[model samples]
Target chain A: MDATPQMTCQTAREAFPEFLDFRTAPTARMAERSHLAVCPDCQREFATLTRIATALDEAPSALPSGRMRQRFYAMLEEEKHSARSIHLAAEREHHARGLSLWRRLGLPLAGCALLAAGFVGGTRFSARSPESQDHSDPEARRQLADLQQRVNAMGQLVGYSLIQQRHSPTVDRLQGVLTSASRENPPPQVINELISALALDPSAHVRLSALDGLAAHLEQEVVRAGVLACLAREENPLVQVSMIDLLATARDASARPAIEKLSTNVTTDRNVRDAARRALAQL
Target chain B: MLAVRDGELNALGELFERHHGRLYGFLLKLTGDRSTAEDLTQTVFQRMLKYRHTYRDQGNFAAWMYHLARRCTADHVRRSSAAPRPIDPADLNLHADDAPHAAGQASVHDDHRLLYAALALLDRDDREVLLLSRFQELSFAEIAGILECSVGAAKVRAHRALRELRDAFFRLQRPTPPVS
Candidate 1:
C-alpha cells in the first residue's frame, strides 16, 4: 500500500475504484492523492473516470411497477399454499386410507359385538327391543359414511383450487389432477375440474394426463360428454389421440362425430387420423 | 437468507423488499430494458430460494446474489443472441413526468451521455466488470468472487475497461467534418 517516487501511471490507475469510492486506507489514499497531484495524464484520466462514475450513479433506471410486485407475491403465495396443501393432502390420504381399511373390517366386528351383546341381554330380558339395535347400527354406519364424504369433499376442494392456478408448473397441476383422480370414488366436481384441464390446459402433457384422469371416470355421463367434446377442440394431436382412445375405451356413442371428423380431416396427423378411425370403428 | 434456508419463507420476502430496488437498477443498467430487468430481478430471488441450501453462512450474500444475477443475464443473452440491439437512453425509464426530482436526475451532460454510449460498445464481460466495481460499489475481492477470478485480475479487468471507456468517450467527442 506504500507509494514510491517511481510509481507509474499504470500503477496509479489500478487504485481507480478504491480511490473513487474512498475504499483505500487513509495512508494509501494520501499517497494516491499525491501521485495524482504530480501526474497530469493520470490526473486527467482520474477526472474523466470520476465524471463517468458520477453519471453512472445518477443513471436513471425504472423501479419495478406494482404489477410486477403483485405477480411475484402471487407466485410466492401460490408456491407456499401449494406446498402446504400437498403435504396435508399426502398426510390425509395416508390416514384416510388407513381409516378406510379399519372401517371395512372394524364396522363388521363392532356390529357382531353389538349383536352378541343384544342376544345375551335378550335371554335375560324377555322383551329386549329389536328396533333399538337396528337404530344404533344404522346411525354408526351413517356416521362413517359422513366422515368419508367429508374427506372426499376436502380432496375435491384442494384439487379444484390447484387445477385453477394460472401460474403453477405443469407438473404440479398434473400432479393435483392425478392425485384427485386416483381416489377410489372422486366427487363429480373433481371429475369436472379434470375435464376442464383436459380441454383448456396450455401444456399438451397436462392435457394428456387430464384425459387419462377422465378416462377412469367415463361411467359418469357428464365426464363422458366432456371428454368427447374435448377431443373435437383439442389442438395437440397427442392429446387428441389420447382423448379418442379414452372415448373408444368407454364405448361412448357421443364421441362418434368427433372421431369421424378427425378421421376424415387430411390436415390431421396420419397417426392421429388412423387412431381416430380406429376409435370410430370401436364406437 | 439463513432463515430462508431453514424453511422460513417469509424471510425471503424481507430480503426481496430490501434488495429488489438495487437488484433491479443493476439489471436495468446491464440489460438496458426495464422488463428484462424486472424479470431478472425476480429470477435472482427465485434462485436464492431454490439454491438457498448451497449458501454458506460465511459467504458474502451480495456476491452470491450477483453471481446468480450474472448467470440469469447470461442465460437471457444466450436465448436472445440473434437480435442484440444497442441500448437507447430513451428506453431508460426516468419517471421524469411523475417525479419532479427525476427531471434533473435523468439529465446528464453530453460527455456523460457519450460515456454511457461508449460503455454499451464494450465487451459484455468488460461492461460487467466495470459496472460491478463502479456502480455496485463492490470491493475487488467481492467482484472477484462474483466473477470467479482473482482479486488482482478483477482490478486489472476494471482498469482495462475504464481505459476502453475513456478511449470511447474521446472517440465520441471528436466532431465529424461537415458532410460534403
Candidate 2:
C-alpha cells in the first residue's frame, strides 16, 4: 500500500487554487503534482490556472502622476504648519498666563498690603489728634485712586483665574468666566483668555461661552481672526451655526468665502447649510 | 507607523514613498480611472494621517492601509453620481512590448487582453478579492482582515473569483458559432 494518500483528479482540480499559493504545503503539492502527471484534464486546467495567476502577478501597475505626490506633501506641510502654530500659540498662552498671574495677583496683593500698612499708620497718626485728620487732602485722594485701581485689577485677576481653572467642571468654570467677562469694559487679558478658550477648548458649551464673551470684542482684529479660524475647523453643527451667526453679525466680509463654501457643501448639516445661506445673505 | 502615531509626522513620508505605488495600483484596479485613482490615493494617505492614532502596534500596516484604501474607494463611489468606469485592457499595459518577436507572442498578448477584459467583467467584490490576493500578493489572512471576513471565506472567494475569471477568459477566446 502507498504510504502517501493519492490525490484524485477532482481533488487535484480543487487544490489547483491552493497550489497557486506559494505557501501551500509541500506534501499536498507533491500529491497534486503526481495527480497532474497522470491526469491530462487536471494538467490542462492547472496549466491554465497557473497562467492566469502569472498574468495577474505580471499585470502592470499604474503610476500616479507627480501631482499626487506634490499634493500629498503639500497637505502634510499644511498640517505640520498648523500643528506648529497651535503648539506655539499654546506655549505663548501658557507663558502669558504665568506672567499675568503675577501681574494680576502678585503686584495687586503687594500694593494692597502697602496700602493697608499706610492706612493703619495714618489711622494711628490721626488718632493722636482728631483735628489733624483732613478729608480734603490731595494725598488722601491720591491713595484712594490707587486703592480703587488695585481693587479693579484684583477683580479682573480673579475672573481670569476662574477662566483658567482646569479643576472645575468645564461648564461651571466657563459660565463663571463668561459672567465675569460680560461685565462692562472687560480687560484686554480677559478678552485674550476668551479667544484662547474659543479656539482651544474641547467642550462646545465652553466654546460657546468663549464666543459670547468675545462678542463684545469682535471689533478687534485678533478676536475676529480667532473666531474665523475657529469656524474653519469647527465640526459641531451648533458651534458652526453660532460661529456663522457671530461672523455675519460682525459683518466680516472676509468670512464670506468660507460661508459660501459651507452653504454649497453637500456634506454639511442641513441646518448649518441654511444658517450659512442666511449668514451669506447678511454678509 | 508607531512613530507617526506618536506625532512624528515626517515618518509618514517614508511610509508613503514605500507603499504609494502598490497603493496606487490597487486603487487603479479598483477605480479603473487614473485620475480618480490618483485622487483616492492621496485621500487614503490623508486618512492615514487623520486616523493614525487608531493604528495598533501589533497590526499589519499594509492591512490597515488597505482598510483605509477600501474605505476611500467606497466613499468615492458613494459620493460620485456615476457608476465606476470599466477598466480598459490597454490601460493594464500587459503586452510584452520588449520581448523578441516570436510566433507565440501575439497569442500571449491576446490572452493578456482577454484576461483583463474578463477581470473587468467580474463583480466588484470578486475583482477586489482577486486584486488583493493576486496583484497585491497578500495572504489569505490579510485579505480576510481587510475584507472583514474569515480566512477560509477569503480563500473561497478568491478561488471562486479565479474560476469565474478563467471561464470568462475561455468564453472570450471561443470562436463565434455560425448563424443557422
Candidate 3:
C-alpha cells in the first residue's frame, strides 16, 4: 500500500500496535510511516505513544526483597512434600491391590521363620560366652551402625532439601530437622546444612535454632568458620549475639579476628558490638 | 517449569530465581504497591503448584504464567473494595537514591515521574493493555490470549489505551493554567 493514498488516519491508528512497537513487517511499517509523514494528527499521536513507551522502558522497577524468595520456596517445598506423600499412599494402595492373599500371608510366615532362626542362634551362641557370638563381632556392629547412619543421613538430606528451598520454610519443620541432627553422632552433611542455615537462612529464629543445634559441633573447624562468617555478615543483632556467645562458649580462639571486627564496627548495633567485645574477651 | 510440572519442586526455585525479579517488577508497576506485589508474586507460585496438573506440556509456559499473573491481578482488584489510588510520588521515586551523576538525568527522572503519574490516572484496563504491550513486552497474540479477545480487538484496545495514556500524560504536563 506504499503506492496507495487510501491509508486513512483511522487505519493508521488501528495499526498503532504495529506502529508503536516494531512487531509488524517492514512493508507494514513503511506504509504506516508514509501515512504518518503526510498526516500531522497521526504523527503527533505516534509521537505521544513513542514518548510514553520510551519513558516506561526507562523507568526503574522496584524488585521484591529476599523475604519474598524465602516465602515462595517454603510454599513450594510444602506442596511437593504433600504431593509426594499422596503419591506414596497411592502406591501403597496399588501394592495392596496387586498382591495375592497367598503372597501377603507368605511375607508374615517368612518373618516368623527369620525370628525363630534368630532366637535359636542367639540361644546357642549365648550358651558359650557372649564374646563367642558371631553377631557380637565389632565389625558387624560397626557395619550395622554405619548402615543406620546412612539411612538417617538420607532422611536428613530430604529434610535439608526442604529447608534449602528459598521459599519460606516453616520454623517448626526446620526445628524438627535440627532436633534430629542434634541427636547422638549426627551425620556430617546434616551438620553442614545446619551451618548453612545459620549463615544464610532469612529468619533470625531459624538461624538461632541452627545455632542451638550446632552448638555441640562447634569444635569442628568448618562449623567454627561458618559461624564466624555468619557473625560477620549477619544483620540481625540477636543472631549475631547468639553466634558470639556460641563462639565464646566453644573457646574458639580463631573467632577472635571476626569478633574484633564486629566489636569495632561502628555500623553494628550497640548491643551486638558489646556482645562481640564480651566474646572477644572470653575467647 | 517442566521439572516443576513433573514434581521436582526444587526446580521451581531455579525458575523463581531467574524470573521473580522481572515478575515482581511487572506486579509492582501494575499494583503500584511494593508489598502487594510481593504478596502476589508468592500467590502466583502457589497457584502454579495448585494448578500444575492443568499445565499442558506443549503450551507456552511464559504465556501460561503471564495468564496466571493477569488473573492474579484481576482477582486482587476484585477482592479489594477500593479502586487503585494514584501512584505515589515516593513510590514512583523508587530509584531516587541512585546518585544521578549526569546533568540530563534530573529531567529524565522528572519525566519518569510524570509518565508514572499519568499511567496511574488511566483506567485499569487501559493501564493493563499498555503495560502488557510495552513493559512486559508481550505479543498482541499473547495479549489477546491473556485478555480473552481476538487479535484485532487486542490491537484496538491497545491503540485506545495508548491514546488515553498519551492524553493523560500531556494533561499532567500541561502546566496548571495560571491561577486567575
Candidate 4:
C-alpha cells in the first residue's frame, strides 16, 4: 500500500495552480496526477487550465514603434542637460556670493594699501640725502619713476590674485572681467584669456559673453582662430547659432568650409543647420 | 537603479532597454489600446526617473517599475471622463505571429483569439493578476509588493483569476446553437 494519502478531488482541484507549476514538489504533483487519472472530470478541467496557461505563455508581445526609442533618448538627453544646468547654476550662485563678500571688504582694504604705499614713498623720498633728492639729478629722477611703476604693478597684482582664486568663475564675474578688459587697445594677455574662455567654458552663457568680448578684436588672427575652433566643437545649438552669427558678422570667409560642413551634417540641430547655411551664404 | 539614484542617470537607459518590452506589453494588455499603452509606458519611465530616490536598493527593480506602472494606469483611468469598460475585442490585437506553422495553425490562431477575448472580458482586477502572474511571469511575492497585498493573497487572487479566465475561454470556445 502507498504510504502517501490519496488526495480528494476537491483538494487536487484546489492545488491545480501549484500542480501545473513545475516548481511544485514531485510528490504533491504525483498526488494530483493520480487523482486526475482516476477522475475524468478533474482531468478535463486540468487539461483546459493547461491549455489556457499555454496560450497566454505563447502570446506574442506587441512591438512598439521605432519612434518610441527616439522619444526615450531625447527625453534622457533633456534630463541630463537640465541636471547639468542646475548644478552649474548652483555653483555659479555660490561663486557669486563669495565674490560679493570680497568686493564688500577687499576693495576698501586695497585702496587703503595704495594710499599707505604712496604716503610712505613720499615721506621716504623727502627724507632722502640732499644729493639723492636733488631735482637736477637724472639718476634720482629715474629712481622715483621706477618706484611709482612698482606701486602701480603691486595694485594690479592684488586685483589679479583675487580673480584667480575662484576655480569656477560665474557668468557675472566673467562678464565683469571682460567689461574691464574691453578698454581701447586691451592688453594681449586679456585677449588670450577671453579667447580661451570662448573655446572651453562649459556654460553657454559664459561662452556667449566671451564671444561678445572678442567681437572688437575679431580682426586679429588669434581671435578669429579661436572662434573658428569653437564653431567646430560646439554641441549646443544656441551657442553654435551665436558663433555662426558672429562669424557671419565678421565676414570671416575662411570659416566658409566649416560652416558648409555644419550645414550639411544630418545630426546637427535643425536651427543650427539653418544658421550655418545662412552663414555660409554670407561668407 | 541605485546608479540612477546616485546620479549616474545613464544607467536608466540600460534598465529601460532591458525591461521596456515586457512593460509595454503589460500595459498594452492592461489598457487594451496601443497608443494609450505607449503613452503610459513613457509616463512609467519618467516617474521612475523622477522618484528614483525612493527606491530601496534591496527591492526588485521590476516590482518597483510595475508599482509605478499601476499608479500611472490608475491615474489615467481617473483622468478620463468615462468609467473603465471592457476592451473591444478588435483593440486586443490578438495576432499570433509566433504560432507554429502546421496543419493546426488555424486552430492555434483561433485559440489565441478566444483567449485574448476572454482576457478582455475579465474584470480589471482579475485581468491585472493574470497579466502579472502569467504574462509578466512575476513571482507572487513581487506581485504582492506591487499590489500592496500579502503573498498568500496574491496567490489566491491569481488562482481565482485564472479559473475565471479558463471558464470564459471555454464559454467562448463553445459553438452557438443555430436559431430555429
Go through the candidates in order and give the clash count of each.
0, 0, 6, 0
List TM-score per model, in order.
0.56, 0.64, 0.57, 0.58
Q: Give the distance in Å from residue A226's predicted Cα in candidate 2 to where it truly belongs.
A: 26
After the best TM-score superposition of candidate 2, give how far the Cα of residue A281 lies from its true spot, in angstroms: 33
Candidate 1 wrong stretches, greater than 4 Å: A1-5, A29-32, A93-283, B82-87, B95-112
| Alpha-carbon local distance difference test for all models | 0.75, 0.80, 0.75, 0.77
Best by TM-score: 2
Clashing pairs for predicted structure model 2, backbone only: none
DockQ, per model, reads 0.34, 0.35, 0.33, 0.25
lDDT of each residue in A110-221, candidate 2, tens digit only: 7668767876886787668755556577776676678677667766766677677654457656865676666777777888788777777778888888888888788898
Q: Give stretches of model 2 more than 4 Å off.
A: A1-14, A28-41, A123-283, B81-83, B89-105
Q: Of the pair 2 and 4, which is ahead by TM-score?
A: 2
Tens-place lDDT digits, model 3, residues B3-99: 8777787888888887787788777777777788889889998898888778887766767877899899999999994455555544543555543
lDDT of 2 by residue, B1-180 (tens): 999899899999999999998999888877778889889899999998888889998778998999899888888877894445656555553325534257876666677667777887888788889888885457788999999999888988998888888888889889889999
Superposed Cα deviation of residue B157, candidate 3 (Å): 0.6
Candidate 1 on B1-180: residue-level lDDT in tens? 888788787787888888887888777767766788888898888788778889888877788888999999999999987232345655555565533243553444454467667877788888889889875557788999999999989988987887787788778778877998
Q: Which candidate leads in lDDT? A: 2
Question: What TM-score, to 2 decimal places, does chain A of model 3 have?
Answer: 0.48
Of 1 and 4, the candidate ahead on DockQ is 1
Candidate 4 Cα misplacement greater than 4 A, ranges: A1-7, A25-37, A103-283, B81-99
